[model samples]
Target chain A: MSTSRERVLARVRAALTDVPADEPVVRPVERPYADSHGMGAALEVLEDRLRDYKALVRRVPADRLAEEVAAALERRGASTVAVPDGIDADWFSRTEAVRRPDSRDRPLELRELDSVDGVVTACAVAIAETGTIVLDGGPDQGRRAITLVPDYHLCVVRADQVVDGVPQGVRRLDPARPLTWISGPSATSDIELNRVEGVHGPRTLEVLLVE
Target chain B: MSATFLGIPPFPEAARAAVNDSRLRHNLRKATHTIRDKRGAVVTELEDDWERLRSEGAAIKSHTLRHLDHYLEQLEASVERAGGHVHWAADAEEANEIVTRLVRATGETDVVKVKSMATQEIELNNALAEAGITAYETDLAELIVQLGDDLPSHILVPAIHLGRAQIRETFLAQMAEWGVPAPEGLTDDPRALAEAARVHLRERFLRTRTAISGANFAVADSGTLVVLESEGNGRMCLTLPETLISVVGIEKIVPTWADLEVFLQTLPRSSTGERMNPYTSTWTGVTPGDGPQEFHLVLLDNGRTDVLADTVGRQALRCIRCSACLNTCPVYERTGGHAYGSVYPGPIGAILTPQLRGMSSEVDEALPYASSLCGACYEVCPVAIDIPEVLVHLREEVAAGSGHLGEKAVMKGAEAVLGSSHALEAAQRAAGAARNLVPRHLPGMAGAWTDTRDLPDVPAESFRQWWNKHEKGQS
Candidate 1:
C-alpha cells in the first residue's frame, strides 16, 4: 500500500547519504563562458544567421512594415491569413487576403488553422548569434497554435529586441509564459541525419525585421 | 504498437551477429560519421570556449545530483502550485501504470506521442496498449520504427540503422497498417519519405485528444518542462492535445530557469549539429485556453537512485542524452545500438544500462565489457561523463558478483602471488625454466586469455634475478 512517491524519495535520500550533512544544498554555479559571442552589428549578424537556416529574412524601415508583410504573403499566393488577436493591425492592412482574427474566448479549431495559408505575429526577443526568434504569448503573438498549425509563419522582429546570445535573451523573458524558440521552419534529420525542411509545424518561416 | 524486446541475447552475442551484417555496418558508419563531422565543426566554431562550457555543464549536473532529493521536492511543489499533477514512479512498471491510467481517465482511446527516450526506456507504449489505449508515434524516425515493428536503434535518429531504400520499402509495405497508406510511387528520397510521414501523422495530430511526452530538462524553480527537437512533431503533440502527460526522469531537473541557457546552447550543437534545432518549446503546467487543458508529470526513478549510490558510476547521471558519445564511439559505430540491448545505446549505454537495470541479466552483465575503453566518448560528451571510468567500475562489480566463481578464484590466487615479491619471483623462475613447453593456445583457467592472445616467451632469467646481477637492481 506504500505510494511510489514516498518509496522513490526514500531510495534517493538513502543513495545520497554520502553528501555532507553540514554543507549548503545550493552552491554558486560557475559560468566561465562569455555572455555572448562578441561580434559587432548583432542585428545584421542575426539576419545572416536566420538566412543560413533557410529562412527568408527581410529588413524594412518602420514605415514600410505593412508593405513588406503584404509582399511576403503575396509571394506565397495566400488567399486567407489567420492573424493573432492583438497583433499590429496595420501590418496586414495592405494584404488583399481575407483576415481572420483569432477568437478571444476559445481557441481556433485545428481544421480552421489548417485551412489558412499564412500567419504573422510579433516576437518577444531574437538571439542574433543563433539566428533564433522566441514567441512568448504576447498581445501580438496569440497562443502557441496560431503560428504552429498554419503552413507559413511570417514573424516580425524589431531591431531593438535583438540580443547577442541565448543568455541575454533568457534574461529578457519570463519562464512562466509559454515560449517557443524557432530557428527555422519545421525540419527533420531522422532520415540519415539529413535535414529536410517542412514537417508538422509551419513549413516555411519568413522573418521580417523592422528598424 | 506493443513490441517487446524480451528474450533478447546478451551484448556480446548480439554484437557478434550485428558486426557480421555488412549492410547494417555500412548504414551505421555512414550515419554516425555524418553527424560526428557536423558536431565537430559546430563545436569547433565556439573556438576556445567549448571546453569551459563542457566543464560548467558537468559541474551544474553534479551539484544537482548532490542535492537531488531537495530539488525534486522543490520541483514537485512548483509543479503542484502551477496547477499540474505530479506523480512519482519508483521504476518502469510504476511509471507506465501512472501514464496509462492518466490517459484512460481522459476516456480517450487514441493518443499521439513525441519521441521521448524516457517513455521508450519504460516502454510506455506497450503498457498503454495493455490498458486498451493506442499510442501513435508522430516523430518521423519513430514512425519508421513503429511501422517496421522494430526497436529504436539510436537515441537521436531511431531508424539510423535503416537506409533510404529500406525505409522506402518499410513505408510502401507498412504505412497502411498504421493509418494512411503511402502515396503511389514513393521513392527512396529522404524528402519523399519525410513527406509521407508528415501526411500520415497530420490527421492523427488534429484528432488525438491525449498526448504522451518525455522532457529533456525540468526547471525546479519554475516547474517548467523543456523539449528540444529538430522536427515539429513534438510541437504538434505538445500543442494539439487536450490532455498532456509528460514522463520525465528525476535527474532531468536543473535548479533555475537561467540554467536552460547552458543546455539549450550545448544540446543542439552536440546533438543534430545545428546552431539551434528547428524548434524548442517550453511550457509550464496548463494554460486555460491554449494547448493542453490538463497536465500530469510522472517523475521516474527506475533504479536511478541505485545508480547514484556508486561514487564513480554516478557521473553517468550527468548525461543530457545529446548522443555525442554515440556518434564518436568506435565500438558503437560498428556494432550498432541493438548490441547494447537497452533503450540507451553506445558508450553511455555501456555504463548506464547496467546501473539502471542492474547486472542481473546476461545483457546487463555483458554491457560493461562492450566498450574498448577508448575515451572517445568522454572527449565528446557535452557534460563530460567519463564513460570509460564507469565501465571499469561496473566491470569490477561484475567480477565481484555471485556468478563469476572462476574469475573470483583466479583473482584470489593472483592476490596471493602478486601481493608477494618472493611468491612472484619463484613462480616466474619456474616458468622461465619451463619456457620451451609454452603453448600458442593456453589450456584450463588460462585458456580464456590465451585463446585470443599469444603467451609471451619466458626469458632465461627473470627480471628480478637479472636485475640482482646487474646494477639495474631490484633489491
Candidate 2:
C-alpha cells in the first residue's frame, strides 16, 4: 500500500488539476492595513484597555518598579511567590514572601508550582492596542507551566517594550521559542455569552509598567 | 445516551421543531445577539483598517489554498526539523487509529483535552473509549457538554442551547460522576459555576500524562502551531503534559510566521468579540523541559481534498471557524445549531458540511437549503467566504442530482408555457376565469412549500388582458 502521506499528497495534487501548472508557488499578500495605530499616549491606552479587561495596571518610575512590585505582591498577600530566574532580586527585597526561583535546569515541580501564591516575570513585548503581553520563555519567564499553574500573575513591563499594535508585536517575536500572549486575566464568554473573568489561569493579573 | 450527530433528522424537519421550541429559541436569541453586539463594537474600534485587514486575510488564504501541496510539504519538513514527529491521515478512521495507538504506547489510559473542533468532527473521544482510554474535556463548556451527555451546539460556546439553570443542575448531578463534585446548593450564577469547574479540573490537569488538541494555525516556515482560546484549560493541556498530539486540518496552514498578524487581530473580535482572547499559545514543537517532551502532529484530510475539488465550494476552506457568521445569521438565530445536524453548524456549516460529507445523505442534501441567502454571513466573515453564493451553488447541485422530480416537472411545464407568449396568455385567462375557485393553499407535494408561506393573490385578469382593454379604450 502507498503511504498515507503519498496518497494524501496525490489526492491534493489531483484536486488542484484545474490550476495552471506554471502558477507561482508563492504570491505577495496585499497589505493595505496600517502597521500601527500611532497612539499619542500608548501607555495610557494600554492602562485603559487593561483596566477594561479587568486587569490591574500600575505605572511607576524606573527606580520605583521594585517598590511597586513589592507593594502589589503585598496587596495580594502572596506569601510564597514563584520568581523565575533573571528577575530583579531587588523587586522582592521589600516583600517578605519566600521566593522560589525556577529555571530550565532546576525547574519547580508541578505540585510545587501549583502551590505558589503567584508568579512574577518580565514580558518579551507588549501590545498597547490590545492590552496584551507576550512571554517567550526567556530567562525571566522560566517556563510556560510556572506562570500558568499559579492563581495570580504579576507581569513587569518596561515602557520601551510596549508596541502600538498587533502587527508590530508579531514582528518582534521569534517563533522558535514557546510564546504566550495574554490580554488580561483568564476570562470566558461560554456561559450564556456573558463575559466572566477569573477562570483557570491567574485570576488576578497585576502589571507593573516601569517608565 | 451520549449525544451523537448520527441518525438525526434533516434540516427542514429538525429546524421546524427547533423554531417551535420557545425555550431553545429564547436561549439562542439571547446568546447570538449579545455576541453580535460585542463583535460590532470591537470591529468598529478599528474601522479604518478593518476592511483592509479583511481583504489581506482573504488574499493570504486564497494564495495558500492554491499552493497547498507545496506548503504542506514545507510544513512537514519544518516540523520534522523542529523535533516533532508528523503523521498523515486521509480520513477520520485512520486518524483515530493513529491517536489511539499513540496513547496506548504511552501506557496511559487517561488523557486531557482542550476544546477542539477537529477532535469533535472525528469523534475521537468515542474511538478512544473503544480502545479502553478515557478522555476528559477540561474546557468548562466542553465539560458541561460531556457531563450532561449533550452535543455541542455552538462553535465558541458548546452549551449555548442550555441556560444557566440547566447548567447548574447538570453540574450538581453529574459533576461527581466525573472527577469532582459540585458544591452543595449551587446557584445558577455564571461566576459560581466557573469556580466550581476550576476546582474540578485542576487535579486532572496536573495528573494527565498525555493531551489531545487541535491547532488554530500552523506556519509552514517556522513549523509552529498556534491555538487561540479564552479559557486557561488550553494553556494547561498545552503546557503540562508529557506527550502532546495535535490533530490539525490540512487547510489551517499559513505560509510564514508573520502571517499570524492578520488572523491574531481578526479572530478574537470575530469569534468571541474580544480585543484579544485571554490566551494565545504558540509552540513550534518539542520544547524539552519547558513544555511537552514529546510532540506529535497529526495532519488530517477527512474529505477536505474533495472540498478542494470544487471550484465554487472550495472558498469554505478559507474559514477560520470564527462563528461570526453564525451570530449574524437570522435563520440560525431562530433554529439554533442543533437543527443543522453537524459538528459545524450555521451558514459556514450549511455550505461546508455538504461538501465535506458529500450530498449523499438526507442531512447533507438538506444543508444547502438551510440559508435564506440573507448575505449577513458573508458581510461579517473575517476571511470573506461568500456563504450565500456557495449555498446557491450547492442548492443547484442538489436540485440537478436526484429527487425533486415533482418540482422539476412543474418547472418544465412552466418553461413550456412561458416559452410561447400565446400559450402564456391563454393560461393566464384560464387562471383568471377560475380565480374564485382557487384554494388558500396548493394541494399535493407543493403544499409543503406553502405550509409556512402564502401564495400570491391572483389578479382579476392577466396583465395582457388589462393592457389590451385599456389600449382599445384609448384608441
**Predictions in order: lDDT:** 0.88, 0.91
The TM-scores, chain A only, for the candidates as listed are: 0.95, 0.96
Clashing pairs in 1: none
TM-score of 2: 0.94
Model 2 lDDT at residue B305: 92
Off by over 4 Å in 1: B404-475
* Docking band of candidate 2: medium
Worst 10 residues of 1 chain A by lDDT: A100-109
Q: Could you tell me which 10 consecutive residues in candidate 2 chain B have the lowest summed lDDT?
A: B445-454
Residue-wise C-alpha lDDT for candidate 2, range A1-211, written one tens digit per residue: 1399999999999989988999998776556798776655889989988999999999999888777877998899988999888787887767788899998788999999989999999999999999999999998887999999999999999999999999999999999999999999998888999989999999999999889
Q: Any residue pairs clashing in model 2, and if so which? A: none
Native contacts kept (model 1): 0.80
